[model samples]
Target: MQDADKNGNTNQTDGPEHSALLGRMLKGEKLALAKLVTSVENDAPFVPEIMEEIYPKTGRCYSFGVTGPPGAGKSTLVDKLIARLRAQDKMVGVIAVDPSSPFSGGAVLGDRIRMQRHALDEGVFIRSLGTRGTGGGLSRATGEVLRLFDAFGMDVVIIETVGVGQTELDIVDIADTTLVVLVPESGDTVQTMKAGLMEIADVFIVNKADREGADKMVSDLKGMVELNDCRETDWKVPVLLSQANQDQGVDEIYKELNNHREFLDTHTTEGERKAKIRRRHFLEILGHRFVKKVEMLAREDERFRDYLEEVQQDDANPYEITKTFFQDEEFARKIFGATQTKPS
Candidate 1:
């Protein structure tokens, strides 16, 4: 879709400029990669074009999502994971999704002080993204950014979420393997299950395993996993212990992650999983774009603006209004006519 500037003129970011940037990125230019990531995060008009150009270069990277409660040592775990991947001579890329400041729209904990040690490593590429008030503990552009990292030749791309919540489990929609981190005293095992963590976690890490109640927590998670049995695959979610700060038990956690990856590679269910994710991704983008197009039309059409005003004032119920609006042929003709030629 084409975007109009505040002056109501078409503003696009396509053409030779973005093509040159993509070409440089394909040649392993870090600066080009960084620039493309920034453009994606900002939702630049040229993103669709960039995604089209790089589509063939993706699928080589293994994406992992490290998510859990706040103060669960997720950053430390990610740092250690990056080290492990790098030790094996694999290039790693990290997308640290941090909470955004309501006032500034910037990440409150960008750079995550614990992970700064890898800042200078040539094989390690790290980018901190502000959630920007989006739900699901990640930015809307995170999936696109991962595509850029994959195209840039990262063997493994890790996304550290902004603390998992009931509705913040979108990481599972993107990651090939999801590691849900928790602490010893975080809460009861039932609470974890109620929080929707049980369904999304492929591997569980009880960080700060040296703390009190560590063993009990591990036992509880294993019990819960067993109770919800009747699985299609032989892989059982392993609740491993880890003192990430001390680097103890991390190796085993990495081993479990590898096992999970191997399971996905070998199982027939792999196709089903990918199909599910593809459906979710498609629906999400379609919904976002459809809403955006309607909003743009509402801004330009007098009758649509009046409809929006009525909805805002509660004079008409949104559900009925949406149904009626879509059924109106004139409404469809006008809106479709305006957006017929998509931005290149």
Candidate 2:
């Protein structure tokens, strides 16, 4: 969720015990399943330790993030997508995030119930993460968990975000290909084009296409695409219509996805660009971690507060406060010790 400490690999308590357990889980040890879930679900005392042991081994999966408006039927879309993927003998991982309502977790778990036909199927692993107010589209450990599945050798990882509003469109940070799903009736065509979604989607899907207005929505999407100003290349972001519940157009989607993958594979500059983006994102996460830590320490430290009070009263400025905090050898050492010294 939005809790600062809950998101990163900074929570390392058990120096070795949790590491061995994480190693086992990565090695296919069955018992580690419950332990890992428990560690994450209860915000376990040693999760920071667990993430540290597992972080480096991540970034190994094709992480796909699925997001859209609340009633876009993202869950059902994922279910149908999984079914099609399973036919290819591909291993799939699903991460569903929901709001902070008391039944949020229960509702997400119920998605598994909707797709129970795949319960006995080994090719699928379904996980439901309560959003816990980690807005901008995902849970705190969303990327980490996708990496876990990747390290586990999952062929595909699907992330489902609860809300698809502007503020919730955080999937772009994690997913290589983020498909913004919209139903015909939701007026997603106009909502999407007007809200800058045209750039976010590598592909636009109009789900529930069997409805009466479906064709108009699809045409509307195509019109928007044609009117798109970015004509630098022949690559047009395709708009596809699908009736997922009826098992329609899944193959076309697979074909488009594969084509996109192929495009990335051949584009030489992509590697460097992606590396820069990833580094920037990790740095932002680190920045968030640092800001939270400083805030927490300042609140708990009398010296920092007296200085803050003086600054608030305009008797002293931030530069002086910053100088005092940095010049205080004891405080400086503690802060540095508590923070990660390495960039990675």
RMSD of each: 3.7, 4.8
TM-score each candidate. Answer: 0.87, 0.79
Where is the poorest 10-residue window by lDDT in model 1?
A: 1-10
**Residue 51 miss distance in model 2 (angstroms):** 3.7
Which is the leading candidate under TM-score?
1
Q: Which stretches of candidate 2 lie over 4 Å from their true place?
A: 1-13, 30-34, 37-49, 99-107, 111-113, 133-139, 192-195, 230-234, 268-270, 305-332, 337-344
Cα error of candidate 2 at position 98, Å = 2.5
Against the true structure, whose lDDT is highest? 1
Q: Write the per-residue lDDT of candidate 1 for residues 1-344, one digit (tens) a residue.
A: 33433212124445688889999999999889988887776666566678877877887889988987777898998889888988899999888765543321224434463677887899988887764423232445778889899999999999887567643476555888899898987776448454377678888888998899989888988887887654456678998999999999999999998998998888746668767866876777666556556755655666777778878874678998889888988777655555453222
> Model 1, stretches more than 4 Å misplaced?
1-14, 99-113, 133-139, 188-195, 230-232, 269-273, 312-314, 334-344
Instruction: State each model's CA lDDT, in order.
Output: 0.75, 0.65
